[model samples]
Target: MARQSGRHFSGPRLSPEQAARQGRISQLAIARLGAREAIAFLNGNDEKLGGRPLDLAIESIEGLRAAEQRLDEWAEA
Candidate 1:
């Protein structure tokens, strides 16, 4: 099986250790999304001659959306 980060299995059921690890991983994932959103929001405020910053922000939002989709799929599984 593909091993998930910060996860460990023990016996027939998920132990407290595994649950705690999963919790930490979930927290980190949430934090990452929050950071990405913040970056995108801040990037949106940039006003420059060229559209480079806007382009970058759009790319970042796309990447973040993809990542969120993947995470949702993983959670469903």
Candidate 2:
């Protein structure tokens, strides 16, 4: 017996407005810090930083929540 992959796909494409909204969301997700700073911090290259995965994970979650809130506000406007 062969296993079948079940998948359902839909949608033609995102409209220009939708694409712009997505771009805004992406920007909001990283608004808290510079990309380079975040990369260095996550890799434990920053001074006063110990290699703590848990702390980094928590920070990432917080950042996501903030970005979600911003997106919500944008949607309401």
Candidate 3:
């Protein structure tokens, strides 16, 4: 018998608006921090986020709003 792959297939789902916002945030990240740094920033755990994953933060409505606010602040700084 063939062994089944253990990897989960489903990924985090987002609404259209949420996705658009995510894209905007990503663009801001790229512009402010450079592409590589922005990617790392999104993938890395954040101190200000109480040690939560940034990926998780950008997945939900509230989380995305918070992330945008934080990113906006970062841009201004």
- Give the root-mean-square deviation of each candidate in angstroms: 16.3, 12.8, 4.4
Each model's TM-score? 0.28, 0.30, 0.59
What is the C-alpha local distance difference test score of candidate 3?
A: 0.70
Question: For model 2, what is the error of residue 1's alpha carbon versus the real structure, in angstroms, after optimal superposition?
Answer: 40
Kindly list the per-residue Cα lDDT of model 1 for residues 1-77, writing each as its tens digit.
Answer: 89679967685664565454444434544565465643453344333312233233234544434434444543454
Best by TM-score: 3
lDDT of 3 at 39: 81
lDDT of 3 at 34: 90
Each model's lDDT: 0.43, 0.44, 0.70
What are the per-residue Cα lDDT tens digits for candidate 2 across 1-77? 99868876675665565455445445543464456533433334222223332233334554434445533443354
Which pairs clash (backbone N, Cα, C closer than 3 Å) in model 3? none
Candidate 1: residue 30 Cα off by (Å): 0.4
